[model samples]
Target: MRISLDGQVALVTGAGRGLGRAIALALAGAGAEVVSVARTPADLNSLREEGGALIRPMVADVLDASFYAQVEALERLDILVNNAGGNKPMPMVDVDDETLDRLLALNIRSVYKTAQAAARRMVAQGSGVIVNMSSQMGRVGSPRRTVYCLSKHAVEGLTKAMAVELAPNGVRVVSVAPTFVLTPMTEPMFANPDFSAFVMDRIPMKKLASVEDVANAVVFLASPAAGLITGESLAIDGGWTAQ
Candidate 1:
């Protein structure tokens, strides 16, 4: 059966490219009016060209405090996809103050701020869904990923906290944790044969996730079909965490 989000409004962060762009397109395909937000206008322009009238491109950095005002300004936000975040792999000892600060600001602080703004509106309306873009690294650990893992762990914790608090108000908070999705950001890693093999070896499926794979999960979590799923991190990890 097909999921329908007809008449709903969705706000997707980092919608310029990669997984975020895919999620924005998926939402539009499901009939939601999608507000695609990203710092780059060109990416949003491409999204608009592809998604047509169903997609509204908005240029903004999710890290900006004023961005919450834009989110709060949405008169009717049915769904919020916090997909904006960045990562740089470094050994635990090599991780500097600046790197840690940047990761926390982008991954944890921005997500928390955006969620609060969206949750407030959802509480007022008495219903909404929030899907955060986490990572399989959030569930498990890896070398040189301490910072990324930490941020995602915080995301999971915050998701649970918000889920419990907002359930009474008809808002559901959840996260999607996918393994090594093949995106522009990750192509460089996959370009190295040894690193690519290492990633493949970790997954029982021996394959990386696709943009559509994660996007499908996001669409489901954002839809009414997943009405009862909350306070959980849905892993699209290709069995990597099972081991």
Candidate 2:
């Protein structure tokens, strides 16, 4: 069944590339006007160039608390996608204070701030959808992925809490938790044979979930098809969580 979002307005964080880019494009293709937020000018420019009138570049750090007002004023934002996050490989014990802080700020705090801001706007609008990106690691566990897993688990928690609170306002919050998507951030991990095996072995499909896989889930949650799905996390991990 084809889903369409003809009159919807959306704001997607990390829209420069990877899962974010895929989600933004999918939303637009389904007829939503998308506000693409990202830190890099070139990535945002690329989206604008490729998306034409369907996409608007919204440059702002998701970490910025004041960006909510900017976002609310700029777009109706019928849909919101929290898809920004990253952290390099590090043993849990060896991870420094600075790195941990930075990871938490970008992955966890940013998602919270953006979702909070979007929730207020959505509540006022009286109808909206918010899709937060998470990971199978959030539901399961893995070695060396401690920080990333922690950040995503927090995302899952936020989604649940916001869904319950925002449901009264007609706002639904959901999450797409994926395993080993091919994004720039994950390139190095895929290159490492041991890491790749560690990831693939647990996944029943023995393959990576594409950006499109995660993006499609985001679009579904943002659309009417998922009108009843709230505070639920849909895992696209090829059964990694099942394992």
Candidate 3:
């Protein structure tokens, strides 16, 4: 079946590049008016040039409390893709206090705050969809990614909680958990042949998730097609999580 977000308004964080950019483009292509948020102006500009009127670029750090104000100002918001997060891979024993704090702030705190703000607006409007960006690590543990895994595990829990609380208000909350996708954020890991091969070996499909793969899933979750699908994490891991 075809999914269409015609005339819908979607807010996608981290839209400056990578999967966020892909999701923004996909949403726009699906006829949604997209509000793309990112800290980098260049990436936002690039998206605007490509998406034109359908994509409205907004430059702001998701950590900023005012960011929610900006989202609330939107005339109407139907979809929220909480995609802004980062990870600094390191062994749990070697992880510093500061690094752990930063990861928690970016991955968990920001998601909770942003979703809380969006859910408030959505409850008033009486309908909405929230897609939190998670990772395969969220479900399964990984070496040198303890902090990242913990943050995403929290995200999974938060997604379920939000879904339960918002369902009564006609708002659905879900998460998209993807295996290693080739993106600027992950190029460093893929740069090492051994590391790349090790990653590929874990995926039964022997392929990494693509930007389009995750973006398409987000679109489906946000579309009427997934009207009843909430409080769940859709794994786009190419079978990595299955292993």
Q: By TM-score, who's the top model here?
A: 1
Better of 1 and 2 by TM-score: 1
**lDDT, candidates in the order shown:** 0.94, 0.87, 0.93
| lDDT for each residue of candidate 3 in 1-243, tens digit (9 for 90 to 100) | 668899999999999999999999999999999999999999999899999899998999999999988787777999999999999988889999999999999999999999988988899999999999999999999899999999999999999999998999999999999999998778888989999998998999999888999999999999999999999999999899886
Minimum summed lDDT over a 10-residue window in model 1 is located at 132-141
Error of 2 at 12 (Å): 0.4
- Cα lDDT of model 1 by residue, 1-243, tens digit: 789999999999999999999999999999999999999998899899999899999999988889999898889999999999999998999999999999999999999999999998899999999998898888889999999999999999999999999999999999999999998789989889999989999999888899999998999999989999999999998999988
Candidate 1 vs candidate 2: the lDDT winner is 1
121 Cα displacement, candidate 2 (Å):
0.6
Model 1, backbone clash pairs (residues 3+ apart or across chains), number: 0
Identify the runs in model 3 with alpha carbons over 4 angstroms from their true place: none
TM-score of 3: 0.97
Q: Give the candidates in order of TM-score, highest first.
A: 1, 3, 2
Candidate 2: stretches off by over 4 Å:
none
